[model samples]
Target: MSSVKERFLRYVQVETTSCEANECCPSTPGQKVLGEMLVKEMQAMGVSGARMDEHGYVYGFIPAKGKTDAPAIGLIAHMDTSDAVPGKTVPQVIEHYDGGVIRLKNGVEISGFSFLESLKGQDLIVTSGDSVLGADDKAGVAEIMTLCEKMLAPDAPDHGKICVAFTPDEEIGRGADLFDIPGFGAEFAYTVDGGALGELEYECFNAASCKVTVKGVNIHPGSAKNQMINASLVAMEFAGMLPPWERPEHTEGYEGFYHLMEMSGNEEAAELKYILRDHDIRKLDARKQMMNTACEVLNKKYGDGTVLVELRDSYRNMKEIVEQHPEILERAKAAFLANGVEPIVKAIRGGTDGAQLSFRGLPCPNLSTGGYNFHGRKELVPVQAMEKMTEVLVTLVSVK
Candidate 1:
């Protein structure tokens, strides 16, 4: 059976970046490739019913060594990597970290933070600065797989029925879109996709995808004067209208932001895509209204049909649902403490598959994979944390 680190390294080599441009179920074929690999590996570990569904979701079953009266726990992690930075790259393994400024290569360093102080003396896996290390979910995947391998051992500990799922297109926000929650059959689940070693999160931002379109009349450059209304300029102006202090970089700790995700077009037409987020539902609604208001003001400046704003809700805070089932969090915290890790219960600034899964009646929460700097070239994971997390999963599923 492969170790967590080995599985992580091998899996990261596969390019599984889920494309937002694609409308397909997976949005990328590499997700299917990784899904197949997960199935084969699980089957090799003597797990039953390990198979990838038609839409590229992988599911497997692990029967308890002895039957007990405990909820069937599901362990889930996404199979797709973010398209933010190139997530398809081999990681540079550091056997031991001295922990100062970890320079991957010339002019590239993972420094300027106090977080590295804790990683000293631990084994670290990092990217070469050209691409992301893919630890965001792959580390979670490895931990779950390693946990399965241990559960199948001759002297394996007792656990209730185990359900494992690997989803695709999580980065594109469709990971739970095609999810077959009923068939998976877990009373509750935990997504092992989070940063740091001990993060246990249930609350996530109320998310919405915003699209702003600007249309303009164009004329000859020489005849342009006031006749040619520049759409791109108007789009920029609309962006300027939003509070500049209310962006991702300027905010933290329950502070919401209007993140401009994408913007493009010429003077004749332009489109700006943003993701609006807030922890409070009222504030989330206000943020949406703010966008619509901006569009209204811009339309008055140009014309009635000049600017258009479209908003789509992605996910909501899982706190309300997860709070109803507090035992899951209690169990996770106990498991973390048992494994010599502190449980860092915090609210997620971003949404997870757990946020959606919880609202879908799974009462899901997120666990940390001991990874950091997700969705960027600076991504890395601690070796020992992954191992501990694997143990944590074991204890979480183990019937006392």
Candidate 2:
């Protein structure tokens, strides 16, 4: 069986960054490339049904052994990495970390992370400052593949029906849009796409996307007094109306925030893109109302039709759906304890594929891949944590 570290190091070399501008299913060609490779690996491990669909989703199955009557369980992970940084990487392995500042190739330093001190004396996998480490989901992919490879061994532990899937474009929030839930053939599933070891999450933020457009009349400056209306200035005013303290950088835990993702404009027209998130549906609605109020204020100042806003919901909190079935959480916690790891249940500040999957009748929760500082150049994952998580997965499916 392949170690999780070996698999992760090999998989991160593939460029699978997802693009938000593209409306395609996979959103990028590299996702398909990774999916094809995963399917081939599954087939080589005796998974006869391994295949990649047209949408770049890879699926396979492991029939129940020693106990055929158990319910089918699904394991899921996305194949795409975040577009926050470049996807191509040069991996650096540090053997026996000394718990100090880790300087990468391009003068990027990894420090000040609260979890770094706890990871001392363990081997870590990092990358050069040129790109992200891709541990956000690829580490999850590697761990799942390692688990599947182990389950197929001759001395493998007893298990029920296991369904495995790898999705694409999760970074852009479309990972579960084209998912075939019925065809996935799982009573319930778990998305192995979280951070830190021993993390088990079932709740996530209710999410929405907001777009603000400012339309301005531009006149010749030579004869302009009150005739010119600068759209960029109006856009800045609209942004200043919102509470600056309520943002991603200032909030933590269950505190909700409105994140300004992108803004571009000139004198004639301007556009601002934002993502709204709150664990409470009512709070999310309030955030929407706040956006409307800002638009109304701007339009009142610059005449009618000057400011336009578009607010659309992306996903809801999964806590409402996951709490309906307690057995799912129990099984995961039991498996963690069985592997000598205490389970840490917390709410996810951002949404996951499982958030949408749970609302779609799958009751899926999120699991960790022993990674830290995701979606940036300083991202890293411990070798021992990955190995321990693979063992936990083994016990999770083994018949008790």
Candidate 3:
């Protein structure tokens, strides 16, 4: 059987960075490439029906070991890496770390912080200094794949049918947008896409994307006077209207924040993009209303057409949906404990595909793949963690 770490290394070698610039499904062609690769791998592993959909989603089926009443379970992970940094480079596996400051190519160094102590005797998969390690969800993908391989063995333990799905464009928050829950044929699912070891998340932030546009009159500086409205200044003023203390850097746990993602403009026009998040639906609504109010007050000062804000709901907290079926959580906790890993339950400060899936009637929750410092060059995963998580996935799908 191929180790989960080896499978993860193979998966990350494919460049699957999702693009926000593209409005198309899957976001980038690289995502399709990875999905196709996964489908082939699954088919080679005996999932003859495995296939990649037109939208770049890959699905595979594992029939029950014997006819039984156990509910079919689904395991999900994203195929795409984050677009925040370059993600084409394959990872370098550092074997049996001494926990010192490990140096990489291009003069980049991986800081051996106190966290390194935990993995002192284990192998580590790290970046080569030029790109992200792609362990964010790829590790999750590998773990699920390894589980499939194990479960497919002739002498494997008896289990219920299992569904496996690999999605694209998760980095851009569209992972669950095109997901076919009914077709997946699972009573409930779990997304293997959290950080650190043993992290479990059922609650996630209620999310929204906001775009504020400012229309300003541009005139000659000498003749500008009261006739000219600086769009850049107006955009800054609009940002200023938000509470300074409430931002991603300042908030934690259940706190809500308004993140100013991007702003670009000339005096004639300007646009600001923001992502608002809160753990509570009521607070999320209030945050959106606050953004609208900010625009309203600014428009009142600068004229009716000067400021315009557009707010769109993205996803909601999954706690309510997840609560309805307590067995999912209980089973997951049992799996973790069975693998000798302690479960750490926490609310995700950001949203996941599981959050949207839960809302879509899947009652999905998030689980960790034992990766840390994701979406950047410093991303790394321990070999032991991947092995343990693979065991957890096997336990999760097996009939108890």
Candidate 4:
């Protein structure tokens, strides 16, 4: 069997970065490139139904080797990387890390004082400084591939029928938009797409996206101070009116946050984009209402039509769905412990494809990929942790 590291390295070179502005199902052609590769790989491994659909989803079935009574479980991962950066990754390996600082060729550094400090004694795979490592979900794809290959081996333990899917556009939050849950025929599913070694998450933020547009009267600078109304300054004021402590940089754990994702302005107009998140449905609704109130206050100050706020719900927390199928979580926890790793059950600060899938009638939970600092230049993954994660997947499918 090919090692997880080798599989991951091969997957990341495919350049499957998702495009948020695209209207297509997969959202980018690169996703199809990876999907085709996955279909070929799955077929080579003896998966009978390995095929890629027109929408770029690759699905296959691995029949049970010895058992016929166990429930069919689905293993899923996204093929696309985040559009936050480029993903034509050139990965480098650090053998037997001494644990100080790793300097990239492009002047970026992963310092020991950073989260990478804990990975001191392990082998690490990182980017070459100009691109993202694509470990966010590619590591997930590798884990699933490794597990499927192991299941086909003669020495492998018995397992129920397993369904596998490689989805696209997860980074842009449309991973499950076209998912065929009923056709996939799984009692439950797990997305191997979380961070760190033993992370297993079922709860994700109830999410929304807001856009605030400000219209201002642009006057000549020579006209005088009283005639000038700078729209950019008003946009900054709108941002400042929110509670400072509610921002992402200040919160952790169960604390929800309002994140300002983008801002652009001119003398005549300005637009500010924000993403709001909370695990509690009540708090999530309140946050949207708060944005409306803030817009009202600004409108009152700048005139009725000067400020407009548009808020749209993206995805809700998946806990409500997962709670009904508690056995899924229990089995995953047991699998982790069986592999000699402690299960770290926590709430996801951000949304995953599992969040949407759970709402779509699949009790999907997020599993760890053993990657850290994702979607940036300093992204890294521990070799040992990734191998352990692959083992956890195999164990989850094989052990009763």
Candidate with top lDDT is: 2
Question: Which residue segments of model 3 deviate by more than 4 Å?
Answer: 112-114
* Clashing residue pairs in candidate 1 (N, C-alpha, C atoms within 3 angstroms): none
**For each candidate, how many residue pairs have backbone atoms clashing (under 3 Å)?**
0, 0, 0, 0
Q: Over the stretch 46-90, how does candidate 3's per-residue lDDT look in tens digits?
A: 974698888998888899887578889999999898877898876
Worst 10 residues of 1 by lDDT: 105-114
Kindly indicate the candidate among 2 and 4 with the higher lDDT: 2
Model 4 TM-score is: 0.96
RMSD to true structure for each model, in Å: 1.0, 0.9, 1.3, 1.5
lDDT of 1 by residue, 319-384 (tens): 999999989999999999998889999999998898888888898999999999899888889999
RMSD of 2: 0.9
List lDDT for all candidates, in order: 0.91, 0.92, 0.89, 0.90
State in Å the error of residue 332, model 2: 0.6
Off by over 4 Å in 2: none
- Alpha-carbon TM-score of each model against the true structure: 0.98, 0.98, 0.97, 0.96
The lDDT of model 3 is 0.89
How do all the candidates rank in terms of lDDT, highest first?
2, 1, 4, 3
Against the hidden true structure, what lDDT does model 1 obtain?
0.91
Q: Summarize candidate 2's per-residue lDDT along 12-76 as a digit string, tens digits.
A: 99999999899998999999988988998999998758999999998998999998888889999
